[model samples]
Target: MGQFTPESLAASGQAFELTTAGGCGVFVAEVHGERLWIHGAGAVGSKNLTQDGLALFEAMALAGGCRFIRFETDRPGLVRLSKKAGFKTRAFVMEKEIKKC
Candidate 1:
């Protein structure tokens, strides 16, 4: 079983949208304005994950009142999954962490 710790998610600028029973897997997100960014890896070939994944992602965007839902995944399989769920690759963003002295 896997867990999506709130502390870790929050630190990563993400939110936990949903999780499976017995701590199987979780659907996490990074909300920016109206965007709910999801980054999850569930059990292999789990049908529940496939269905719940799409629903959860859609719900995230809707709950945030977003007109568009965007996701980024370098994994070709994951990208295909997102595309099937009506998402498209838009632009890329390069991020760098800053530390305060």
Candidate 2:
């Protein structure tokens, strides 16, 4: 959700609308070679995000010929949820904020 916008997603990724048992939302994914880079997903404020919804996106990626998918998130809840949905941690991400001190 941070630094991602409609313009940005439209610029370089494939956008998908989703309707699930929970509710409706959308996601943006881009094919980075054999991997589908899931840029962002939004089903906020409705209790509408579910595993089925995530799987729906995954299905789309597979049908589009992606061998795998990847994304980044800082929320613990999201990480737990993704793990439950069979997503594994392939690597650790580290970052630091630079200041012109």
> TM-score: which candidate is best?
2
What TM-score does candidate 2 get on C-alpha atoms? 0.78
lDDT of 2 by residue, 43-97 (tens): 6434346576667768877898988878878878778888888899998999998
Off by over 4 Å in 2: 1-4, 45-48
Residue-pair clashes per candidate? 0, 0
Worst 10 residues of 1 by lDDT: 15-24
lDDT of 1 by residue, 1-101 (tens): 46866566566755453455423455456667777776553444455566566777787688878766666566777677777777777988798987999
| C-alpha local distance difference test of each model | 0.64, 0.76
Report the CA-based lDDT of candidate 1 relative to the real structure. Answer: 0.64
Q: Who wins the lDDT comparison?
A: 2
